[model samples]
Target: MESMKNRESKTAGSLIDDPVILRLFERMPHSVQESFTEEQLMHLKVAVGSRGWGEHAVDVRGSFRGWRHRYYYVMLFGRNRRHLTPGQKRIHNLISAAMLTGFVCVGLLIGLLGLYLLKSAAGIDLFPDHSLGIWDWFNSN
Candidate 1:
C-alpha cells in the first residue's frame, strides 16, 4: 500500500513538473488548481497537445544573421487539414465545374473567332451577297 501511494505521488509530481502544465496550473486560482487530479491534468495535456507544431508536407525554416541582427523565417505549405461537410464539398465541386466550363467556352469562342477572321482575310464567303459585316467593321477599326 505504501509503495502504491508513493508511485501515485510520483506520477502526479511528474505531471506538475511539465512546463506547459505548470504554466496552466499557475494561471488558475490556487484552489481551482488543487481541485484537479493527475488524470484530469493528463487529459488536458492530451487534448491541448494533439495538434502539434510542424506537421506539414513542406516545412522550411531557417535563421540568418545580417547587419548585426538575427532574422528567422519559416515557410510551410501542405494539403488542407480541414474536414468539409457534404454540402460544402458539393458546393466546392460545383464551383470547380463552373470554372472549367467557363474556361472551355472562352477558349472555343476565341478559336472560332480566329477561324472567322482567317476566312474573311482569305475572301472565302460561304454565302453569296450576304455579309456578317464583321470584316467591314474590323477593317474600319
Candidate 2:
C-alpha cells in the first residue's frame, strides 16, 4: 500500500514539472489525481511522450498494413456483429462484392491497354490502309 502511494505521488509530482502534462492535468479536477492509479498515469505519460503532450510519438513499423486490412474489413463487413441488423450486414456484403467486381474490371481494362500499347509498338495494323499518316495529311504541296 505504501509503495502504491509512493508511485502515485511520484506520477503526480512529475505532472507538475512537465508543463504540457500539467496542462493536460489542469483540464481535469484535482480529484483526478486520486482517481487514476499509477499504471494508468504511466500509460498516459508514454502516450503523451516525454518530450511533450501535444507531440504524439508512436512506433508503427510493420503493423500499418495489418491495421489497414482490419480497417477495410470493418468498413466493408460492418463492425460489431451484434449491433447490426441482418439486412444491414447483407447490404455491406453486397457492397463489398460490388467493389471487388469493380476492381477486377479495372484490372482487366489495364491489361487490355498494355496489350494494345505492345501491339502498336510492334507495328500491328490497328487502322486500315486508307488511314492517312499525320504528316501526309498536314503537309501542303
Candidate 3:
C-alpha cells in the first residue's frame, strides 16, 4: 500500500509539463533520445526553460502545432544539404540575380504606373469618392 501510494504521487515540475523540454525531446534523433538519462533530461529542461521564449514564440508555436513532427525531423537532419557543383552554383547565382532584378523592375514599373494614373486624370480616384462611385453601385443608397 505504501509503495502504491508513493508511485501514484508525482513531484511538481515534471518534464511532461514543460513545452521547451518536450520540443527538445521531439527534435532529438530517436537514438539520441533513447540513450538520454533522466538527469540529462532534467538538465535540458532547466536549460531550455531558462532561455525565455521571445515575441515570435507564440506565432512559431501556433504554426508548429500541426507540423511539429515534420519540423523536428527537418531541423535534426535536413541541414546536411548537398553541395552544388561549380556550374550549378554559377547558374544558381545567375538565377538569383535575375530574379532580384526582375523584382526591382516590376516594383519600379508599378510605382511609375501608379504615378501616371494619379497624375493623368484629376477626377479619377482609386477609392470611391461620391454618389456616382463604387459605394453607391454596391449600396444603392
Candidate 4:
C-alpha cells in the first residue's frame, strides 16, 4: 500500500506534463533548453465563441454545447545559440565554408585524377603481360 501511494506523488518543480516545447526540444539539433519552472508549464484552455449567434433556438442551426478541448501552443521562441570559438568563427561564413569544402572536394578530385594519369602515363604495369597502350610501345622495344 505504501509503495503504491509513493509512486503517485511527484516532485513539485519537475516537469511531468508534456507541453509543445517539450516535444520540440527533443528534435532541436545542437541545442539545450535551460530548465523551465513548472508554473511556466501551466496553460489555460480558451473557450471558442458559440456558433448559435447568441440565440438559444429550438432548432439549433449549428452550435457546440459540450466542452471543447484546447491546449496552449508553446512555441520555442528563440533558438539556443552559441558564440562560435575564434577558430570556428573564422571559418563560419558561407563563402568561406563553401570555398573550403569546394577546395577539399577539388583537391580530392585532382588527387584521383593525378593518380589515374600517373598510372596511365607511367605504363609500368605492375602485373606482367598486362598491356597498357602507347607506353607499351616504349617497353616492348
Candidate 5:
C-alpha cells in the first residue's frame, strides 16, 4: 500500500487538477474530511500569488493552470461530486462552466455596479465635460 503521506500528496494533486473542485471551495466550506487540511487552498493561493480569495495576483510562473484544474475538481465534487449517470458528466461540466461564467459575469456586474454606485455617490465622472471628442475638437471651439 502507498504510504499515507504519498497517498495524501497524490490525492491532493488529483484534487488540485479539476475545476469543479475549485468552485466548491469558492461557494462553501469543504467537506468534513477537508475541513482541516488546507493544502489544496494553500496550493491555489501559492499559484495565484495572493491569498487566492480576494483580488487575484499575478500567476506564479504561470504553472497555476495545473493548480487551478486541481482546485476546480475538488471544489466541484469534494466528497459528493463524482460519477453521475451516463450523461451526468456533461451536466456536471455545464454546471462547472456555468459556475465559472457566473463568477465572471457577477464580477463584471459588481464592477459596473460599483462604478455606478461610486459615481452616483460621489457625483464624479471619470471623463471631464470640457474634454471634447477628437473629431469635435477639430470641428468646433
Candidate 6:
C-alpha cells in the first residue's frame, strides 16, 4: 500500500512538473487544488497539452488612467512562426513583392535626383534648352 501510494504521488509529481499543468494549477484556488485527485490532474494535463503561447521579440504591456477610466494595452512584435494557408501565403508574397518594388523605386528616384543635382552643380546639361526648374528652385532656397 505504501509503494502504491508512492507510485501515485510520483505520477502526480510528473504531471505537475509540466509547465502548462503547473500554470493551470497555480491559477486554481488552493482549496480547489487540494481537492483534485491524481486522475483529475492527469485529465487536466492531457487536456491542456504542452504547447505554449509563442514567444515575441518585443512585448510591451501597460495600463493608464484617463478621464476617470483605466485602460490597458499590449504590444507584441515578432517574426511569424505560424503555418499559413495557401491563399494567405499568396497574399503575403504579394505584399512582400509590392514593398520591395516600392523600396527599389524610391531608392532609384533618390539616386537619379542626386545625380541630376550633381550635374547641375557642375554646369553639365544633357538638354540645354529645357529645364526641370529643380536647380533654379534649389538655388533660390
Worst ten in a row by lDDT for model 4? 44-53
Measured over all alpha carbons after superposition, the RMSD of each candidate to the real structure, in angstroms, is 12.7, 12.5, 10.8, 22.1, 18.3, 6.9
**Model 6, residue 20: C-alpha shift (Å):** 12
Error of 4 at 112 (Å): 1.3
- Tens digit of per-residue lDDT, candidate 1, span 1-25: 2232343478455666776777686
Collision count for each candidate, in order = 0, 0, 0, 0, 22, 0
Candidate 2 lDDT score relative to the true structure:
0.59
Q: Residue 108 of candidate 4: its Cα lDDT? A: 100
**Candidate 4 lDDT, tens digit per residue, 1-141?**
223123226564444334544554455552234333334433311121222323332323333344675434322333325577878777677668899999999999989766755786765466677653545464477
TM-score of 2: 0.40
Please rank every candidate by TM-score, starting with the best: 6, 1, 2, 3, 5, 4
lDDT of 4 at 13: 40
State the displacement of the C-alpha of residue 30, model 2, in Å, after optimal TM-score superposition: 5.6
Give me the runs in candidate 1 sitting further than 4 Å from their true place. Answer: 1-81
lDDT of 1: 0.79
The candidate scoring highest on TM-score is 6
Model 3 TM-score? 0.32
lDDT of 5 by residue, 57-115 (tens): 33232223574473322222123533588698788899999999999999998897666
How big is the positional error of residue 98 in model 3, measured in Å on the Cα after superposition?
A: 22
lDDT string for model 6 (52-135, tens) is 444678889899998999999999898887899999999999999999999999999999999999999999989979989999
Cα TM-score per model: 0.43, 0.40, 0.32, 0.23, 0.29, 0.52
lDDT of each: 0.79, 0.59, 0.58, 0.49, 0.54, 0.78
Cα deviation at 140, candidate 1, in Å, is 1.3
